[model samples]
Target chain A: MSAVAALSYLVASVLFMSGLKMLSSPKTARKGNISASLGMLIAIVVTLTDEKILDYTFILAGLLTGSAVGVWFALRVQMTAMPQLVGVLNGFGGGASALVAFAEYIRISGDASLSVWTGDAPLDVLITLVLSILIGTVTIVGSMIASAKLHGVMRSAPILYPFQKQTNAAILVAAIVLGVLFVFDPSRWYLLVIIAGLAAILGVTSVIPIGGADMPVVISLMNSYSGLAGAMTGFVLSNNVLIISGTLVGTSGIILTNIMCKAMNRSLANVLFAGVGAEYDPSVQAVEQRTVIRYTPEDAATILESAQSVIIVPGYGLAVAQAQHALQELVNILTAKGMLVRYAIHPVAGRMPGHMNVLLAEANAPYDILMEMDQINDDFQNTDVALVIGANDVVNPAARYKKDSPLYGMPILNVDHARTVMVCKRSLNPGFAGEDNELFYNEKTMMVFGDAKETVTKLVQLMKS
Target chain B: MTEGLMISIYIFVLAAFVGVEVISKVPPLLHTPLMSGSNAISGITLVGSLIAAGEGHGGLSVILGFIAVVLATVNVVGGFLVTDRMLKMFKKEPQKKDQRA
Candidate 1:
């Protein structure tokens, strides 16, 4: 590589690092993204110059088509669909890495003069190549399934059959064995295709058993796999910029995954394998029979009018009903009436980490008022009204002491400590965790049944009158 | 071990540490954007795709490279653009007072 090209890559790597560092605060996040994109632009242009292309037709066509589609998707996607969009994009990145590795293999193996085994440690290159293909293929297929599940194309419930884990384990082991065999005898290249096939199956089987509520972890893990695949391809191509940038993304995903798992108070293995939210248990019928006072939105508004303080808890149901704007309107009205109003965000409240925040931000809610669980958990006790909007399991007090429940160990918001709890939900059904919420049955709790958007809008209207 | 592989390993290890350090500082408020933004960075695989496509390899290699390039570009462009869109919505507070000064 020329000195100029090497120096440019180094600069690009630095830009990526600085950009990520700047993301720590919202004030600089937009600028950080723009700078990182500039870095990408520099890397692409420098790479084009270095490769000495004989034909620009394919490159031009690919670039133009990709840009148009990418722009359309980015511009057209609703805030509620962000997780699905990210999942699809992650899949593309992984698929690209796998394809690049395959192309490299074809380029080298086809030319008798340039042997793949010519390097000092041929095994190193071969291993990297196999790893790239395996990881990349797995990431792409797994991401597609995950996105589909999130998009409602597949059932949100965990899909399980007998001996599922054992099957996934066997497929993985077989793929590894084949990968080693192919490394020894590169002649039987068909092994690569079989490995990719196994990877695709592994992707499906692995993601199918994870329920919708656990998508935050799955999405983050898939993001990590996509980056690791990129790094493996970097090793195959011996590209420093790719290695550095890919590793950065890989670690970022790993960190997010860890944080999500911690917030849910579950181990990574339990999240992946326990299939925690698989079925709505029959035991919930007992809780359903327990009597609870059902309140109207008018009543809720009256209750709110007298409250000195309010903390709103949002969950996935908010996104499903497209009620963020309505909820925000209610918040505005409450604030205008001289009541202290704030939003309490549970980490795993919605479909993904930061899901509720994104939806609320889209509704133009001020970032200052959106509080994390730890920041506001203690204040719930002093708050006059804890308005639960389209939320469930997160506020369930049973998690504090119910050992047999799936949510037993999971950290929940301290909404039960509030003076009065009002819940707006579609029905009395349990949440994705399938655990009946004890908070819903508490004496202080008031259940308001209806579409979240309609109920919140009614509350706003009533308060205005 | 080859000197090139050794250097790449060192770079990889150091970059991993840098990744953890920088990412840990990102608060949960920006976690969604962080996921999408770093996803764009992962599209660096486009570099390899470009090389594969531009080099006059074979029909199959060129085709594979072309598809790879397109996918990587989508990952790059979509990931960054969507992240920017989401981040744009995250305001510290509504613009009520002019503080241009």
Candidate 2:
């Protein structure tokens, strides 16, 4: 490699690493992203300039088009869809890497001189070719499945057969046997096709057994799979840049997948094979003796006006209403009155981690005031009022005690612990996990029936008046 | 083919457009969970990097492969850690039946 090319790669790598590191914290994630992209740009430019390939025009055109689309997506994609977009982009990356590997294999295989120099004219070339093809093909299929699941095209509930475990095992055995055969005799091109088919089936089956609630974790796991596939293909081609980049992606994906599994308090094996949280028990006896207290916007305003301390607990409802900005306005109003105001954010409040924080931050809510469940749950005792906006499962009391409930053992924000719990919701419907919320019937709880944005806006008006 | 490249670009652009449309429609209450869930997708980069590394040949390739492995590892580890920490906050215990007022 030329010294200049090496220097450029080094710089790009450093940029990528630093950008990834900064991405861990939400505050600096945007900057981290920019830095990483810049590194990638440098790498691409340097690679193109240093290579002897005569097709500069196509390369430049591709770069321009890709960048334009990337920029537009970056500018336009909503924060909520960011995950799906990320998934698709990841799939693209895998697809791109796989294509490069295939191209390399094809180039080498067709050239007699290159094949002779590399080794056994057909065998060595074929081995590399098959490995690249397998890995790249798998990455493409697996990522697509993951993206689909995330986007909700497929049912989020686990699809289980009577002998789910045995079926998965059988598929695995077949794929392994085929892989082994291909390794021994590289000429059997059909073996590679079989392996790809099996891998694709594995991807689908692996994700099929996971529930919607566990999608974030599943997506993370598939992401790791895609990366590993990429790195393996890089090895097949003996490309230093591809190998390094692919390995970085694979390891990070696995670690993230593990983190997601742990977030759901599940093991990787359980996530893959246990089919937990998939069956929604509709027969669980909900306590019907308890009475629900209803409050109009004006009534809610009165409660807020008298409260010495108020905490706003946000959930998926708040996100649905896009009320972060209005909610921030309410917080400002309450805080100005010397009321202790804070946001109680559950870990899995929306559909993913830190979903509330991101939305609130977009509305310019002070990061300091956005409290995690552990940080603010205890404070609910001293809190005169807890305003729940569009939250259900996270605040549902059943998650704590109802053993049959899908969310049983799942930690919840203690909004129910507050002296006066006011929930702003459109209806008494259960949450995504499809379980009724007992917190609604608490004596201290009052339902402020309306859209979260409208309710908050009305409450603000009432407070001002 | 260059056509594939063009198609990929179009897909992303469409994806972004769809993303904005959906976010606008989602209730504020769902924001937290949605964001957390979506962030999980970022983990895909780790997978890509790892596969790329495994294809490397000798010397600098090996070193680069190792680096990719480490970076991907960190991303996966840190991401799950944060996610788990978040999920723990939602598991609530049942209150005593007799304590109900």
Candidate 3:
């Protein structure tokens, strides 16, 4: 309400804009974050100073406790668990917003003077409150399920039952019906509570049916919903900063979701409604195999030493095997030999977007040599060897030809185009797509069965000799 | 619609546009940190939480308000700290970990 408060919010919005712009570039991202964080601190301080407080006890308690726990999670969580951590944080944001909106509703309804529906207190508040509670509660439970799946607390695969889609639709309808009842009689607080309960349950059911391959999209979509929930809370509180920042996050999430979907050449509807890669029929025969030539680390080293250029294709296997450091050392040794080595990264190479880039960066791999799917796809033709490390579906040749394959039409790294391809995998098990990789049977491809880290380590040792 | 409602709508529309513009330029590689960063921003519920906590309503409102405050604060702090951790790994210079040097 004060001019200074408004001015600070304006400054905060500007800071948020600049911060997001800086995030687009790697070099200025840290400064961008610090600037945004400073803005947040200013916004919070300004709100506290303006709002009449009976006591700062609860505020201070929340701050200290939350910050301590937050610092612990941030510092203690492994890089491999980043997706799950992000998922959990998104859930926390939604739950917080939902609670805040409902609390505001309770406070207003208790105030006899301000609870009027005609003049000062209108239907708008009711609508916003219903929306905030609905979206926020759903996002919270949905994100929790997502995080659980990612953490292996539950199966990463989509857990399906009879008429799962129909059940989800029914829950959504019930929540909406309850929301309608609350909009008319805002004082009927129990109706709102029932709606929140239904929305929360809806969240769990909706996300539970989405398979692992689609997790990145589902998580990002939930992030968008949390943003929308925050926006609804901003409306209820009539806070400009909350509204602007919430909108920013919500829009950003939608854009991210779209990008992830586009990268996989899948539609958002297809991703949400039809869970791909979740149901793998083991009954399908993988009998197209001709010959799988086996090789040892010594042979791998010899091939690498003879090659003029090599492309390293990494995947979830690298993360599971913790082979990033060993692979980096191998790249280092290969670099020393005057051999050209570049990394060809798939869009969905790891568990999520940017996963491969950050994981490899943690291993101190030079970022310049790491190329995106489109950036280095063409060069695979001229490369002497493609070292497929703990990778499968991304480099699977079946995507190009087999119409009946689950991976059909999905763009993949053309590792088979290279003169020779060496695959390091544990067994002949299928990938997330639940289809056998024909590239594993390619004449130019050699199956090097072992843990990626140990195999890469052995290759490093052999290179030394 | 009421004048107050109209103002809220106007603010909401303008903010949504601003948000889209701000987020449009972020690159693909930074998507993870970007998601984390925006998640922190959405924790803007902290403002509402502060108000709810100070309102000193009935027992339920106060309790709910306190829980909300804690959760929002967790979101704000956890989201930013984790994002910062991730971004720190993406430095121009790599760390030296000489295992078998």
Clashes of each: 0, 83, 0
Backbone clash pairs in model 1 (N, Cα, C under 3 Å; residues 3+ apart or in different chains), count: 0
Which candidate has the top score in DockQ?
A: 1
lDDT of 1 by residue, A16-46 (tens): 9999999999999999999999999999999
* Residue A125 of model 2, lDDT score: 37
| Candidate 2 positional error at A193, Å | 3.3
Q: TM-score of chain B, per candidate?
A: 0.91, 0.61, 0.86
List the pairs of residues colliding in candidate 1. none
lDDT of 2: 0.58
Candidate 2: what is its chain A TM-score? 0.85
Candidate 3, A144-240: lDDT as tens digits: 9999988899987877788988998998888888888878777677888898999989988898878887888988898899999998998888877
lDDT of 2 at B29: 31
Clashing pairs in 3: none
* Over 4 Å off, model 2: A24-27, A108-139, A149-161, A239-245, A273-289, A401-405, B1-101
TM-score of 2: 0.73
Question: Each model's interface RMSD (Å)?
Answer: 1.5, 14.6, 2.0
Q: Please, what is the whole-model Cα lDDT of each candidate in the order they appear?
A: 0.89, 0.58, 0.83
DockQ winner, 1 or 3: 1
Per-candidate DockQ vs. reference: 0.68, 0.04, 0.65
